[model samples]
Target: MAANPWFSWTYVVENADTLWEHTVQHAVLTVEAVAIATVIAVPLGILVSRIRWLAGIVIGTAAVLYTVPSLALFAILAPLLGIGRTPVLIGLVAYALLVILRNTVAGLDAVDPAVLDAARGLGYGPGRVLVHVSLPNALPSVVAGLRLATVSTVAMVTVGVVVGYGGLGQLMFQGFRNNFYRAEIMAATLACVLLAVVLDVAIWAGGRALTPWRERRRA
Candidate 1:
């Protein structure tokens, strides 16, 4: 007889399809932003790494971008990029620059100078040294930066829903509007949290796997 009630949990199930669709859409938004952010940031990062004068200016600009409020950025972009994925993605990509750029710089800086000298001594050209020695060593930091950019993108995508692209934030807003306190809202929050956790853990694991020297040193 208790098969149905006001809070029987069916309310959550009812909205599952819409919620899933939004989650998938949000993931797509996140992945695309990360891809674009990585490409732009990494090249600039490498260039600035080689030129000390540009590093402060470029990275400082990225830090400034990170400080701007997401909502404000969205509002500014909305008129130009219009209300859709384009503006939202643009904002997320901007927000990602600090993490990506900083990490790239750090990785490049952390490369062993002695190793670089040895490579040069061995007749390795600049191109060969960068390709075989520098990049591989800098990879951990690059991945760290990519991971940070990805997580930031995921979180920011929900905020972009304010521009009408619609995501988990939309679901939560709808639940509040309807005054139903639907389980769907809880589920959406859980999904977002899960996504964050998965990214964090995966990055952590991958970072460790890539840097076995660190593990051996600790051992």
Candidate 2:
């Protein structure tokens, strides 16, 4: 009788070393893309939130960019960037902006008017108030956005297989090419899932640590 390929540990054991390398590559790609997106999107979000009229245009543009098909984007980008990690990184960054930007805008907008007024009343300059009060208060929302972007990026990185930059996704692709090698496919899928779960938990814990005041307020 044939054993269940999905549950087979053979591929995992056979390819353990390569699997680890691919996992690391996947993690690095995901982290770099998200970090870049956050840096660019957070500031743009703040600017749009501040200049109300610009919000529509900036966000709308991001939305349109986000709506572009991932493969199509890759096809377009591969020509300009020339394969490897650059196109994948650029695509992931583009995919992430909408979530991060909207979250940043929402977070900043959600900051209490009373809190801002109090900071100003205390002689805090606009810049100081934003840094000390507005940003801190809005951090929960921002972190929430980061969590979403992180998970989405993890899933999207698999699409990077289209451009020879799949990371763990490469395992699955190899399995597909090798006649339904379910063990490889399953292992790769499991690794990606586990990575996403771990990242989500870490982000959640970091958010809690950063927003200790929320716990105090509740208490």
CA lDDT of each prediction against the hidden true structure: 0.82, 0.92
Worst ten-residue run, lDDT, model 1? Answer: 1-10
Query: By TM-score, how accurate is candidate 1?
Result: 0.87
lDDT score for residue 40 of model 2: 98
lDDT digits (tens) for residues 1-219 of candidate 2:
155377567767878899899999999999999999999999998899889999989999999999999999999999999888999999999999999999999999988898899999999998998889988998999999999999999999999999899899999898889887788888999999999999989999999999999999999
Evaluated against the true structure, the overall lDDT of model 1 is: 0.82
Query: By summed lDDT, which 10 consecutive residues of candidate 2 come out lowest?
Result: 1-10
Measured against the true structure, the TM-scores of the candidates, in listed sequence, are 0.87, 0.97
In candidate 2 the C-alpha lDDT for residue 156 amounts to 94
Off by over 4 Å in 1: 1-9, 180-182, 204-219
Please give, for residues 1-219, the per-residue lDDT of candidate 1 as tens digits. 243323435655776688679888877787788889889998998899888999889998999999999999999999998998889988988999889889988999999999999999999998899888887789889998888788777778888878987577777677667664556567767777777677778877987898788778889
